[model samples]
Target: MADTYKFRIDHHGSLIRPAEVLNARARHAAGELDDAGLRAVEDEAISESARQQRKLRMSVVTDGEFRREDFRGAVLDTVGGFRRTGGTDKYGRAQWVADGEVKAGGPLIADGYDGVKAMAGTAAPKAGLPSPAFLAATCFDREISGAAYKSPVELGEALARIIRDEIELLISRGIRLVQLNNFRYASYLFSRGGQPLTLDEAIAVDSIAVDLTAKPEDVRIGLCPTHQVTGTVDRDAATRLFAGLPVDRWVLPYDKGAEGEADLLRAVPADRDAALGIVDPATAELEDVETIMQRMDAAAELKDIENIAVSPSAGFADTAGRAAISADDQRRKLIHVETIARMCWGNEL
Candidate 1:
C-alpha cells in the first residue's frame, strides 16, 4: 500500500502479434528456425509494440506479450513439469497436466521485460502473469495430475509458489506493475458455471500467489478478469475479489455495460484503482468516447476519479494470429481509452 499505482489509463497486457512473429514461431515449431532466430523476430516486433504504447502515452507499457503464444505462455512455456495431453479442456484451452512438481525452468517473461524496459522510456513496464486459480482450473486434470497433485488446490498452491518467484524476479528487475490475468472466478463464481474450485477457494488460491516476498509498496499488482470470449462478474464475486485480494488494481469487465456493473464497482477498495473495461476488445468497433466518458462519470460517482482507470474489455490478442480486432482497431481503441481518461480525469492521466 505505497500508493504508487497511479495509472489512470491501462489496457489488458496482450496486444496483437504481428505476422512475422507468428510466422517465425510457426517456423521454430517446425524446426525450420532456431531459438535465436525466432527471438530476433520477437524482439523486433516487441520493440515496435513498446514504441507504439509509448507513442500512445499509456502510463503503463507492456511488451504486447509478443514472446508468449497466449498470456499463459509466460508460465506454461517457461515452467517445467507439465505434460501436454494433446487435447483441450471444456473451455477450449490446451490441457497441460501436472505430471511432476511444477517449477520454473528459468526466468519467466524476463526477456519480454527486457524488451519493454529498453523501449518503454518513461512508462512503467508491466508484467502479465497467469492467475494460479485460473491455471489450476484449466490445467489441473484430476486423473493426470492426481499423482503429482492430490487436488486442484494442491496444484494451485504449487503454482502460487512459482508465480511468487516470478514476481520477485520482476520487482528486482525494476518492473513495478504486475497484472494477473484471471478468468476462472468470472466463469464459475460470477456466472455460476460449474467448476473445480468454489469462489472462496479460487480467491484463497490467488491470495497465496500474490503473497509476494517483495515490499508491498515496491510493486503494483492488478487482476484483470476476462472469460475466454466474453464474461462479467456477479456482485458477490466482485466484492470478494476486490476486497479480499491483496492486489492494488482491479481491471474489471464492463464492456457489456457499466450500468449493470455499478454495484460491483462499489466493491473496489478506496485504495485500489478500478480500471473500467469501457471499450470492447473482442470487436473491431471503436467505442464512442462520449459514451465511455459517461461510464467514467458513473464510476467516479462510486469512487474517486484518481482511483478510476480505463481499458479494453480484454486483450486484443489472447492467442497468436486470432485477434478479432484489426491492428488499426486496437490502436484506436487504446487511443479512445487515453482520450476518455484525459476528458474525465484531465492531467491526472
Candidate 2:
C-alpha cells in the first residue's frame, strides 16, 4: 500500500442537474435528439460541475454522475442483456431481469472521467461504480433471471467481472480514486426488502468486485453507502465489512450524530480512513458548522484526525429531480463540509 490516502472533504457522486441537462434528457428520451446531440449537452454540464467543485476547493471531484439517470444506472445502461420488467421494486425502482449473458457494450464511466479530468484544476477525479451486490440484489429475480444464471450469486459474479473491466479501463486512463456505491449493505442494516444476499454473502460479492491485483500503488479505493443508514449498526458486521473490503476508506452517514455513533468508528480498520457524513442532503436547511465540528471531534477522539473526513450523507440527487434541495442549498452543504474539514485539519483538505 502507499504510505497514506486521505480525503479531508468529499461528496457523494451525484449532484443536482441544471434545468438544461434535464430538458435535454427528456428530449433524448422522446427521440427528439440524437446520441451525439445529447452527449454534447452532458459534456458541458459535467465541465461546469467540475469547475464548481474546484471553486469550492473540494478534496476530490466527480463528474457529478451527470450522464447517468441514476447513480447505479450506469451498469445497466452500458452493459447489455438485462430485460426490463414492467415492475418496480419496494423502493419504486424499475426492476431488471437478467435473461441473457451480459457484456460491456461500450465505455461506462470513462467518458465522464475524461470530462472531469479535463476541468478538475487541483482536485483528484473520482469515479463511483455501483457495487455488484446492490445491482444483483435489486435487479436479479429468482424466476426471471434463471435463464441467464442459476442464482443471484452467479449473476453477481458476472457483474463483478463487467465492473472490474470498467475499473481497469478507468485505471488505464489514470484514475486514482474509485468508490463502490455499496448500498446493499444498508439493506442488511435497516432490514429493507429486495436484498437476496445476507451480510456475509454481500461482503463476499463486494470483495470479488474490487479485486484489483495490478493497480498502481497510489490507486485508492473506497466504499460509500448510497442510502442513509442511521442509529446504531451491528459492530461485528461493521468490523467484518470494513476489514473485508480492500478499500482505503469508508464514507458513512451520521446525519443526526446519534448517541454512540462515534464509537462505530472503531469498526473501521486502522489501515482505512472514515469520512463522516454530517451534512444532510435531503433537506434544504444548512447545517451548523459548530455542530459538524463537534461530530468530527467525537470521531477524532476514536480515530486519528488524519484518517477522518466529512461529506454529505448521500448524493445530492441519486435520481434526476429526486433530492428536494436546490442547487444553492447543495453548494452551501458542501461548503459546510469544507469549512468543517479546514477547522479540524487545517489545510489538509
Candidate 3:
C-alpha cells in the first residue's frame, strides 16, 4: 500500500437509498405525508448514506445528493422561470421543462450545506450541483429566455453569478469540496445532441462558471467532464477542455473505452490534480484490483502515479436507477476503489 492517496466516489448528485426515503418521496407526492414528514425521512436517508461512506473508510463523505431528483432541474428549480411539465414521460418521471421567462430566484444553495453538514458528522462534508453549463444548455429556451435577457450570453453570465454565489455559500458553511457536473460537454461532443457551444465558446463559458475563491485550501473546487466521448477519445477536444478548466481537481470520465485515452494524462494541467475514473459505473462488472492497476499503469506511462487520484468513472446513482447496478454493487465498487488506493498508493505490497 502506498499509504497516501486521494479518492472520491464522484459527485453523483443523487444517492441510492433505502425504501424508506424512496417511499417517503412517493407518499409526499401522493399527499400521504406532510412536508415535515417527508423531510424527516430525507434527513435520515442522508445520515445513513453518510454512514455508509464512512463505513467504507472514506476520509471525505457527502450526503449522496439524496435530496435531488434531476440534479440539473434541482438547480433550475431554485432559479425562477421554469416549471415541471405536469405530464410524465412514459417512464413516469416528472419532467421539469423551461417554458417561462427566466427570473432571478433565491439563493440556490441556501441551507443545503447546513443540512448536509449537520448529518455528515466528522467526515469531510462535500456537496455539488449540476453544472452551470448543463443548466444553460438544457434549460434556457431561446424564445423564453430571450424575453428576460438581452442574449444567451447574458443568461449564461446570470447563471455563473448564481453558481458562484452558491459556491460562496458552501465555503461559508465550512463545506470543503464542491463539484460541478459537466458531462454534457462530452455528450455534445460525441452524441447527436449538439453541444451548447462550440469548443472555444464552451471553454470560455465554463471558465466563468468555475471561477471561485475559497478562503482556505481545505475548501477545494472540482469538476467532472462527464463520460460521453464515445468510440475513441477526441484527444484535441478533450485536452483543450481539461487544460482550460481551472478547477483544483479534474474528475475525468474514463471507463471501458479509456485505453486509447491514456494520453489524457499528458493534457491534464500540471497545477491541477486528477481523479482518473478507472471503473465502469454503468455496469455491475467487478474490476479486480489488477484491472485498475493496468489502467493505473497506462496512466503511469504518461504521468507519475502520484500525479493522479482514483474513483469510479462516474457516480453510481447519478440518474437514479439509470446505472442499473444494485446498491450492494455500488458498495463493492467503493470497496474496490478504496482497496486499490491502498494497494497502489498506500505502500509497497
Candidate 4:
C-alpha cells in the first residue's frame, strides 16, 4: 500500500538574489558584465543554493529555480520561440504571449533536468527528487484569429501535452512525486460569474491532466482554491470528480481552516491522504500550536488521523522579494513545520 502520509517543505529553489541576477543579465545583454564574470556569478549562486538546502534539512530540495530568470513570469519569457502579442482582457488592451509564432514546441528540460540531477545527487535527501511546480497561477491559452481559446476541452488538451513532457522528464530521473502548480484552475473557476467552468468541465480538465501524467497507483495530485474564492472545498463535487482516479493526496489552502478540513475529509476517500497547510506561506508569523491541534482534531474526526501532512499554503518564499521577510521570519516558519510534524506523526501535541 502507499504510505499513509508524508510531510515536506518547498524550498524556493531560486537563487537568494534572483532580482540581482536578472538585473545583471539585462546589463550583460546590454554589454555590462563580461562573459567570464557572468558565468562565475551564476555558478556561485547555484552552488550556494544547494548548500543552503542541505543546511536547512529540506527533504525535497529544489534547484533554487535559478536557471529561470523569473519563476512566475519567466515561463512566457524563456520558453523558446514564444512571442508577446497584444490582446484584450477584462481591464482593457493587454499583452498576450504564445509560442506558435516562435516555435511549435515548448521549453526543453533535458539540460535543466540534468543540472538538477547533478545537484540533487550530491545532497541527496530521503526524497531524492525535486518537485518542480509547473503552471502555478497561470493559464495556457492560445489565440486563433484574435480569440483566446476559452473552451475547456481544447485548452485542457493543450495543457496536458505540455504537462506530459514535464512528467516524463521527472519520471526519467526516477522522481516519484511531481506536483503541478495549478492556481489558475481555481482562478478560472471563481472569475466573473463565479463558476467559469461547469462541474463536467472542471472534472474534464483535471482528469485529463492526471491521466496523462500519472498511473492510477503512482501519482498524488494537489489542488487549492484561488485566494479570490471563499468557503470550504466542494466535498461532494471533489469526491465525484476524483473518484477512481490516481490522486492519492490533496493539498488545500491554509486559511480554509476547520470547515475546509471537514470538506476534504468528506471529499477524499479513506484510502487516500490529505495535506493540510497549517501555516500561511505569505507571512512570517509562526502558527500557534494549540490552534493547529484543534484543526487537526477536526480533520481526525472525519478521516484517518494518520493521513495528514502539515505544510504551508504554497512555497515558503515568494519569488518576488516584495514581502521582504527577515531571518526571524524563517525561524517562525520552522516552528510551524515542527508543529505539523508532531501532529502528523502522532506525537504529543
Candidate 5:
C-alpha cells in the first residue's frame, strides 16, 4: 500500500452543466460568437474553473469540463460511422441513440490549453477520461455490426488510441495524474442476454487502454460500478486480474444505507491505496460524520488503515439548481476527511 496520503473529488461538472454548456456552444458556433470570440470564452471559463479549484483547497482538480460539449453524448458524436436512431427513454421521452456499425476516429485531442493551465494554477490538475461503459452506453449499440470492424475489440482499439492521445495531451500540458472514469465495468456482469465480456476479458480490455496511455507511475484508474453496493466486486478476483499492473489507486462506490458497503470494504485489496467513497455524489442528502466514522472504523478493520482515503462515493449529484452545501456541512465533511487522514498516516485514531 502507498504510504503517502491522497484524496480526490468525483468528476461531475459535465453532469452539472451539460445542457447549458452544450446549448451555449451550439449557439456560439451558430454565430453567437465568431471563432476567435468563442475561443476566448472557452479560455476564460477554463481559467475561472482553476481558480475555483484553488479556492476549494482540493489537492487535485479537473478542468470542470467547460470545454466539453456534452458529458455523455459528444464522444459518440465524434466517433464517425454511427447511424442515429430514434429511441424512447424509460420515461417515454423521445431520445436519439447511436446505432449501426462505425469506424473509429483516429486519435484527437482537446484543443483547449487554457482549461489545463487554469487547473494547474495551484494544485496539480489531472485530465480525466470517460469509462468504456459510459461511452458504450451512450454510443455503441450491440445490434450494430460493422464490416470494417468485426467485433467491439476492433472498435475499442480505435477508441483506445483516441484515449491514449488524450492522456498524452494532458501529460504534455503538465498534468500528472490522469483519471480514467469507467462506471460501466461491473454493470456488464449483470447484463441479461447481452454479449458482454467476462470479468477476465473486461480486465484485459482495460489493461490494453491503460498500457497504451499511461506510464507505470503517471496514472490512476478509477472504476465505478453502475449501481451502489453491488455484491459483484470481488477483491481476490480483482487482485488476480490486476496483478503486476502499475495501478496506484482504486475507487469503488460506497453508497449510504447500502448492504453492499460492508462487502465492498471487505473486497478492497490491502496492497494498493484506496479511495473509500463515503458520500453519495448523485444525491443532495448530506452525510453525517458520525455515521461515516463508524463505517470507516469498520472498513479499517477489514483493510489496513494506512491504505484508505475518504471521498464521496461518486461525483457531485446531478440535481439541477441544487443549493451549494453550507459552510458547516463542508466543514464537517472536511473534518471527516482529516480524521481519516490522521488515522491513516498519523496513526492518531
Candidate 6:
C-alpha cells in the first residue's frame, strides 16, 4: 500500500478534557443527573474534543472516548460470556475483569466517528477500538474463560472475529482510520519478562484480527504499542516480530532516551510507517518544539525521515478520572509535534 498519509500529526483516541465527564458520570449513576442531562454534557464535550483536534490542524480527530466510563468497559459489557466478577484494586475501588465465554454480542465501540460529524464537524475522524489482542490478553482466566473457550487459543480467535465485525461496521460507515489499541502488550511480549502468549502467535493473531474493512490502501490501520522492549530478552528476534503484517503504521512508544530505539526502528516493515511517541504522558511539564525536534532528529538518524510521524507517548487522559497532563499542557504537546514536524518537513502540513 502506498503511504495513506503524508507526514501528518494526530492522536490516539482519548483526549484531555476537563473534569466534567467524570463528574457527570458519577451524577448520572447517583440519579442526580438524568440520562439525558448526562448525555447532553458528554455530547458537548465530544464536540469540544473534536474541535480542539481540528484547531491543531490534525489529520485525524477523535471524539475523546467521552461516552464510555472506562476504556475496557465497552467490550467487556457487550460481549457474550463475560460477567463482572467481584474484585478490587490496591486503591480499594471495586474492580472487575470479564470472566466468561468469548462470544459475540453488542458493538464493541459506539460510533465516535458519527459523533464527530454531528458535534465537532471534522472531515478527518478516527474511529478506534480496543485491539482484539487486548481482549485476548486481558480476559484470559483459566477457570472463567476456559469454561467457555476450549483453550486460550480459542478465546483469542473468538475475540478476533468479534473485533473484525466491529471494524467492518466502522469501515462501512466510511470511517477510514481504525486504530487497534494494544495498550503496550505487543511490546511487552518482547521484554525480558516472560509473556503469557508467544510473540509470534500474538502478531499473527493481531494481524488476522485487524486485517478488516477496506484494502490496506484505503484504510489506515494503526497499532498503538506502548512498551519499549528491554534488554532482558532477545531484542533481535523480538524486534523482527513486526515483519510482514497487514498493519499500515506502528504508533510506537518512546519514553526514554533514543539510544535503544535503533533496533525497533530497523525492525519496521518496509511498507509501513512509524509514529513515534515523543512526549511523555506521565508528566505534565510542557515540551517546546525544539525538544520534540530532538527526538525527531534522533529517529531521522536511525531511518529515513519520511517513515515517521510524531505523537505523545500515550493518550492525554491516562485514565478516565485522571488527566495525565492539564488540558493546556496536552494542547501544547500536540502543537509542539505539528510545529516541529512542519519545520522538519518544509512547513507543508
Please give, for residues 43-136, the per-residue lDDT of candidate 3 as tens digits.
8777777777777766567777666665564476567767775766553556654555555456675465555566556556777777666666
Per-residue lDDT over 54-168 for candidate 6, one digit per residue giving the tens place of the 0 to 100 score: 7787767777878764555556646777655577545342354446656665566645456676543444567767766666766677776666775555677777888788878
Candidate 1 local lDDT, 1-349, one digit each (tens): 5235677678888999998999999999999999999989988888889989999989888988888878888888888878678997564667777777888877888755778888888778888999998888888877778888998999998898889888888888978788998776666435767889887888889998886655546468888765332335476777777788888888777665534467667878887777778888888787776676777777778888776777887888887788887999899888888887788767754
Against the reference, the lDDT scores of all candidates come to 0.79, 0.79, 0.66, 0.48, 0.53, 0.67
lDDT of 5 by residue, 72-166 (tens): 33345456665546774452423433354444454333556546555565555655566443454444445564454555555555556656566
Tell me the spans in candidate 2 whose CA falls farther than 4 Å from its real position. 1-3, 190-194
Superposition TM-score, candidate 1 onto the true structure: 0.93
Best by TM-score: 2
- Candidate 6 matches the true fold with a TM-score of 0.88
Shift of residue 98 alpha carbon in model 4, Å: 3.3
lDDT for 338 (candidate 5): 49
Residue 8 accuracy (lDDT) in model 3: 41
Cα misplacement distance, residue 284 of candidate 3 (Å): 2.3
Relative to the unseen true structure, what is the C-alpha lDDT of residue 215 in candidate 6, on a scale of 0 to 100?
Answer: 59
Listed per candidate, the RMSD to the true structure in angstroms reads: 2.1, 1.9, 3.6, 5.3, 4.7, 2.8
Candidates 1 and 5 compared: the better one by lDDT is 1
After aligning candidate 5 to the native by TM-score, how far in Å is the CA of 171 from where it should be? 2.2
Candidate 4 lDDT over 1-349, as tens digits, reads: 2333243443323333555565766677899898777756656665555555555544444555454433433334434433446564352323434334222154444334443445554333211111112231123343431253444345444555555565555565644444444444443333333443554555555555555534434434444433223544555555664464445556665444645446545666777666666666566666677777877777778776666655566554434343345545754674556546655564532
Worst 10 residues of 5 by lDDT: 315-324
Per-residue lDDT tens digits for candidate 2, residues 1-349, read 3216565677888899988899999999999999999999999999999999999999788988888878778897888878678887666667777778878878888866777988887677888898898888877877778878887788888898888888888888877788889777865554454568777777777788687877777677788853465545666667777787777878888777776355456778777887778888988888877887777777877887777777887889988867788899999889888887788878855
TM-scores for all candidates: the values are: 0.93, 0.94, 0.87, 0.72, 0.75, 0.88
